[model samples]
Target: FQVKKKQFFRNFMTITLFGAVGTMMSFFTISLAAIAIFSRMNIGTLDVSDFLAIGAIFSATDSVCTLQVLNQDETPFLYSLVFGEGVVNDATSVVLFNALQNFDPNQIDAIVILKFLGNFCYLFVSSTFLGVFTGLLSAYVIKKLYIGRHSTDREVALVMLMAYLSYMLAELLDLSGILTVFFCGIVMSHYTWHNVTESSRVTTKHAFATLSFIAETFLFLYVGMDALDIEKWKFAS
Candidate 1:
């Protein structure tokens, strides 16, 4: 994207803050507003905690769609913001949903809110560390084992496998798999990428791109088809 390092970092921070803190704030706002509106209208009674859980569920942004729309304009700041927010949003949604799913509205208090925020911060930081460490370890192993000096196919396979491995391990450890994989990708690109043979590097790049394009194409196609079902159309009305 040719974004300046400082600008990229600043934008990344902004989007990340939106993803984490912004999502939490949005959840609370939506919950309170929905409760107020419903109460005023004398609608069916709803649990505040349940409404908050719904808010968490909807906080997840589709980064793929955001990136696809923004990337065409060559706007690095907007692209970075959308991309970063989408990533963090997914992780935040997961953590927030899990934390609030079993929560009781009657137990709400200032101390509980503080503890919830504390848990979210801790989870975010720990998951990030797990991802970076996995990437670093993979890079170190590839360099020490001289995998790149071997067959290009083997190098490519090893790198791709390690990336998936990080995600799996993160899930096994009850960390945010999405964030772990995200950081793993960043680390692999920055560190391990330089260690690979030129042939393997090109191979990996093209392979990943082709696979991603195909995946996204089919994913959207399926979504479109799913949405066309008349039986499920009542929700929109």
Candidate 2:
């Protein structure tokens, strides 16, 4: 959402190329390489779908740290390209992973491939629309209800809850909750941000930043702990 609209449009093609097409290429490349290596190594046989799923999982890239170091004002095009690519890459990977989950090697055919493509399109489009709708609804509620005029706390709370609502609704419908919440945030920043009180805007911004930092901290901490778990290693051995 912080991305300039004009800049985003200007670099849209590049972003899509690197994001969607590149991710798919990476997924297939990784899957094929893994399959070849495993075959030669005589490792236990694994299904093609399993290898593709793993590829999809690892293909999603995060550009948060890169973007943090980038000066958006000075390098708006570069920043937008990287940012947009990261977003699309993640969405494409998730859609690909979900689509591949139902794949069967024995059933592989032109029709099955077409069906997979159709399902991917359906999930991507539906999830995007759901996110946009939820964001618009939140904006409408904040604008028409005048909650911010009375209490900034209610305004802040409403925005946060609505964001959560979008995620929950997406998950409930078996859609991509991450994409839903992402678009929800974008919409909220675009529309709902203007509807809220000034204090609420500042408060909400800091609150979300703090929450993000805490979440990242815990995520890395847990990952490190899991990696260092001697008992788990012993059990596997």
Candidate 3:
């Protein structure tokens, strides 16, 4: 939503190159290196799938902190590049991870690889379509129903619910909820935002911001707590 459509389109190629292609390269490089290193070490035997899974897990990049520090108005191009790449990168990693989950190291054939690629494409495309469709439907409802005329609260609630609905629907269909939500927000900001009342706009903006902050805080807290689990570390070591 924060990303300008013009900037996104302008940098679309670069973003795809870095996000999808670069992520795949990183995954392969990391997996191969881990496999080579582990083969020479005394650790328990790990299959190629295990190394690939680790690669898939670590290939995703989060640039939220960098984005927070960068002023979008001052550097729109750079901001869009970073933001777009981050979103696509995460989505690609997720799809790749899901594809890898069904991969068989023992059956490393062309058909298997093609199937993996097909699955990734299907998930990515389907998730994006679902998000866009949901967003457009939300905008149409707001523009046609006169919900804003009755109460801004209803409009705000409807917007939030539609966003959640898209995410949940994607997850239910075994697609990428992150991509679904991201595109849903973009569409909502473009179409639905203009259709709602000023009060509903402000309320939805602040509510989403507050929810995002809380979610991020909880995410970091959970990660820190998991990292500090001494018993889990002891078992691993």
Candidate 4:
């Protein structure tokens, strides 16, 4: 257990460092583009707020349902590193976005710094704690219910339903709902049984991974088209 945790910590750090570097590189490239758009064309200047919002939303990296996939087996170290970093940065970006929107750069002070730190700690700890507690509770309920056991098909269905419901509960609570999904996977990890039981677990994971992929793909494609349409409409106006 200690060894695995140590590995987890090392993977987390390496991932975070790379994430920071990637964020810096992304900012630099975006800065250059912003400069070119304003100087080399008729595009007007943008304020700090614009940069902050864009930076916040775009800075987040997602690994889809990779955590579930990892729970099925020993995850490759690189996968752990990258995905872990991406998840953390997602919340950080959102928080930074909110902060920048609320206060101008010139107004930043020690109080603002404390507020930012407080926000991060609150979101991170609450998201994880709620996710884990709910996950464990749900798992215990499922185990005692005996509804999914003995029947492979029923068990897979039960897990899927529970995972979906867990995410919804987290969202309804105004928490990081996706983190709940991650915790669901983690709790389920503790319940892994024999060879046959393990296969059922993998099946459910694969199902979620597939569904999440399709959902993300269609959502992003549609959102991209909507964005383009808005851009064109703005130009006409």
Considering TM-score, which of the candidate structures 2 and 3 is the better prediction for this target?
3
1-237 per-residue lDDT for model 1 (tens digits): 122334456777687788888887887777777777778988677777767876888777688966777763478777777767877888888877766754667888998778777776666777788889988987888888864566798888888898898889878887778788878887888888887888988998888888878998999999999989887888765
Sorted by lDDT (best first), the order is 3, 2, 1, 4
Q: In model 3, which residue pairs have backbone atoms overlapping below 3 Å?
A: none
Name the Cα RMSD for model 3.
Answer: 1.6
User: What tens digits encode model 2's per-residue C-alpha lDDT throughout 1-237?
Assistant: 356767876888998899989999999888889888888988777888878887899899878778889988999989989988998899899988887877776788999999989988887888888898999999999888854565788998999999999999988987888778877888888899888888888898888988987987788789899999999999988
Candidate order (TM-score): 3, 2, 1, 4
Q: Give the TM-score of candidate 3.
A: 0.93
Where does the lowest 10-residue lDDT sum fall in candidate 2? 143-152
lDDT of each: 0.78, 0.86, 0.89, 0.61
- Local lDDT at 230 for model 3: 100
TM-score of each: 0.83, 0.92, 0.93, 0.67
What is the Å distance of residue 237 in model 2 from its true position? Answer: 3.7
- Best prediction by lDDT: 3
Candidate with more favorable, higher TM-score: 1 or 4: 1
- When summed lDDT is taken over every stretch of 10 residues in candidate 1, the lowest stretch is 1-10
> Cα-based RMSD of the predictions, in order?
3.1, 1.9, 1.6, 5.7
lDDT of 3 by residue, 76-151 (tens): 9999999899999999989888888888989988999898889989999999999999999999988888645547
Location of the lowest summed lDDT over 10 successive residues in candidate 4: 1-10
Q: Which stretches of candidate 1 lie over 4 Å from their true place?
A: 1-7, 37-46, 146-148, 233-237
Candidates 1 and 2 compared by TM-score, better number: 2
